[model samples]
Target: MEKITFQLPDDLIAQHPLERRDRCKLLHLDSSSGEMKEHVFADIVNLLRPDDLLVLNDTKVQRARLYGVGGQAGRKVEIFLVDKLKDDEWLCLVRPGKKAHNGDKFYFSAREYCEIISILADGSRRVRFVGAPASEIMEKFGRMPLPPYIKRDDTSVDRKMYQTVYANEGFSIAAPTAGLHFTEELLADIEKTGTEICRIRLDVGRGTFKMIETKTYEKHTMDPEEYWISEESAKQINTAMKKGRRIVAVGSTVTRTLEGCFQSNGEIKASHDETDIFIYPGFQFKVVGAMVTNFHLPESSLLAMVAAFATPEQILTAYNFAVANRYRFYSYGDAMLIS
Candidate 1:
């Protein structure tokens, strides 16, 4: 309920997504007193103990940014696919929405066709691609979900650099920004040091950028992000708990995916479903003991989640330091660890 102020400088906002997926700056935090220490992304290996279990989100990002014509030429429309309907169909939000209507025809690059089939009750439009497989569709006309800060269009480097190296299962519209900093070498070093790695999938939506619209963080319900916890993942996390090892979540998405399937008896069951779990202060964490996340926006859901992990004062202090140090902010920016 405190006043949230974001006075970050414009230069601190990362102009582009990281050129190398794993090469990012990191700030380690002591969850005890909230003290911070700066380090490179690779230094993460030192934080892992042999008995630690780390969970990662393997959900791949789809090229959600789509460009097309409205009912006529020169009426440019941007359809950002947020959720899937079929291989070549999706539920998306359209820009220049005034020009879109059911049964209207649209074009992608003047090369392919799109039709507005129906509008979903929640306001996303049902769109069908007329000429190509959705996988190939993005290769032609889709762009990455570059945060609104970049001030430019997604470039050639974004296609690869925006996603994590381990990303494979496709569903997410935006990259798991925290995982963007992990290199194969870092993963290997952590594994070599006896830390066990596991995976879950949360198809995070483009609503990731949505600002808090409610006065109370408790009042805001999260848009359901698609999630999957496999039998293997559940077994690993539950087993780690049974043995009293720490379970660290790589990002808020991973934290949500794992916590979504958890039961009150401290058991982790495997399931695939949508998750609307919003973690805020006063919530008891069921799975994650530590979290590696990115610097978040003020008065944002992401920052509220961090407040749940540590404390509001701790997070505010870290934010002030990040701003003072000129650390890059938001999705394309530096990383943090609260443990």
Candidate 2:
């Protein structure tokens, strides 16, 4: 975990998104030789080979952040929806939990009410929304769950910019930041270069955001995230791997999903499951040959995973260069391609 720590300058953090999705700068790092190159995000098509396959996480982000008045004192509570347990029931993180007790009801609207059912061992609350479908209720009242580092409230532009061009199934609480750099035109150009594109779904959750809190990195375990790889996608990925083609994961979430579903026989199987896989330095790769990701937080699980993809020293060097060159960092920042 000591290796993960770095002094991330606050000014390097991006407060807002770029005007154009593919207009941001890209840092390309050669994994084998530790060489680095700089390019625009749109230069990605030229960097990819014809036989390479690009995998994307098409999990749509949900409006999981909500504000409501709860308790007998009518205190305002901030609720972050984490995961669903059953119909109308969700695992949620509620701020000022001392006041939001069991059986206490939170009002979303005049007609909508969510009750805290029980407190889980993880310190999250089991909440049941008694109204129309929870999805519908959230769609109407919930705010986009932006990462705290953004330092601003989510705006209308974030509703469009924070999501990927290919996002379809609404499940994730956070955006897969790497994919945010690819515009529809950029993806079309990549496909025109004969790079096969495929999709998988990993509902981005706290597991993707939480950093290593332990003294030893090996002792850290990730919170589980739900993922799904369709049979058609599995066949495509497995066939490409068998034919000796590179599989380029679009984001760290995609990297985790691919590695989580890796088979010992070198085949990728289609399935739906929850994964708690954590990738750091010294971790061996089984499936992903390359990755395109956003500049991550210092000492984060994401940075550790990127270090495993390249090397800690090389990645730190690239980060220092990016910062010196005024390249942005974190969600709504610049992009990086590790090969």
**Which candidate leads the pack in lDDT?**
2
**lDDT, candidate 1, 170-283, per-residue tens:** 678778989988888889989999999999888888768777888887678888777778889889998998888999999989887767667432468787777787877877
Instruction: List TM-score per model, in order.
Output: 0.94, 0.97
Candidate 2 local accuracy as lDDT? 0.89
Total backbone collisions for each predicted model: 0, 0
lDDT for 125 (candidate 2) = 97
lDDT string for model 2 (165-275, tens) is 899995888999999999999999999999999999999988777877888888889988888989999999999988999999999999999998883234677888878
Whole-model lDDT values for every prediction: 0.82, 0.89
The clash tally of candidate 1 reads: 0
Q: What is the lDDT of residue 149 in candidate 2?
A: 92
